[model samples]
Target: MTTETSVDVTRIPRITHDEATAITAVENRKFGEQLRSLGPDDWIASTDCERWDVRAMAAHVVGGAAGQISPREFVRQVRTGRPIVREIGAKHWWDGMNEVQVRERSDVSTDELIAEWDTNSEKARIARNKLPKPIGRLPLLNLPEPVGRQPLTYLFDMGFTRDVWAHRMDIAAATGHPMDLDATHDGRIIADIVAEWAGYFDEPFTLELTGPAGGTFTSGSGGETVRIDALEFMMILAERTEGTGLLQHTLPL
Candidate 1:
């Protein structure tokens, strides 16, 4: 495995607002359907995420969507030291924001949460596409990897897209329901995630994800190989799996 702390900022590709918006729409639609299918009891069931139940996890996902258009909250979140600023401080920031989001939405019905997600996700999509001059080009500091500052496009495209996907899986696992993952749609997002993961480590490793989202990738010298189901691989990145080597190095998204 390659040991490198610096990420090649130039190597990072740019994503158009149109692409990000499209992906966001897909994630929101499926996520909305899943929320609607939940019974009252299922909403309160516990998820793999500690201290977070089905309802709380949903709130967190909705909060992430809502946060995209909420500049004020973003500022406050940064003040509280979000992970993109310092990965080490991420746990506290994540817990604090999640608690606030869940508590504030406690009185909201599941239907309302779903509606709000749709609304905010659209707003975020518009905002991302129409970001004014300098703002769109501004460097993003909130990232799990300490590679370097990235542009706003990267955050909205890679970060938020994967965030929604990961949480969708969380809810599914918690409620014992299967995800509606489509190879083409979900595959695009997961593929981008794999590309990003490749840039993080210089050590040669091979990853083969087996499922509709399955694919093969090589990083560094491609010496060590990891074979896993697509969903389980994502779970591992979410820190829900235990193993050695790359499995221990959690991806930021």
Candidate 2:
């Protein structure tokens, strides 16, 4: 989770709707392909996401999308908090969902898991398209403070898209497979992250990230400057690495 900082929701710049949709498509294809290339040993590998393994992380991605498309059931689960798993320490809505998703898919084969992800990723993309513009302007509930109050557009564009991309990075790192990231598509993702990360601080600062996703960015007024590799900057944002100065302010991926 990122440090919570109040931001004017209206002032935030989002990738265009098309870009958001494209992100979903491209991320899914890449993620699916990466999974396909992994073996059974890789599926059980641990990731940076605390207790979740590769399969569990992938299950959350697919289950999240499945929940979106199945409103009646999803709403029921939210309302009643049914099928809760106390044994796994399911303390929150997402935690419970993550547990359920992994449990439900426990018997599923690796190939099936990859196929299901491809299907659900597409569904998540389509579901985003069907949302009313007015709905996009509404605040998302129960998100981390500051970020929690942001509009649905921010959640879809910044939150959801980044979740998959971050997890893709997680899987690649855990499996020792080189992850594929491009300048245009991946740069857009990193830039959005930088913009939000910038919003967390009161003083001015400059960030210089050098690599495929690298770029120059300014936040607030004149203050300290930090230079880092683009991937390392992301590692800081994802809280995978400790940072100094304004870099210490973590942002949700």
Top of the candidates by TM-score: 2
Off by over 4 Å in 2: 1-13, 76-91, 220-222
Q: For residues 93-145, could you state the per-residue lDDT of candidate 1 as single tens digits? A: 66566565666788999889988986787787666566665776788556556
TM-score of each: 0.82, 0.85
Q: Write the per-residue lDDT of candidate 2 for residues 1-253, one digit (tens) a residue.
A: 1112322322447578877888778877888888889888998999877778998888877766677666664675454444574655665676666666667778888788888887777887787788789988887656663355677777666567788888888888888887787867787777777666666557677667777666777666578877787777787778877888877788767
The lDDT of model 2 is: 0.73
Please report the TM-score between candidate 2 and the true structure.
Answer: 0.85
lDDT of 1: 0.71
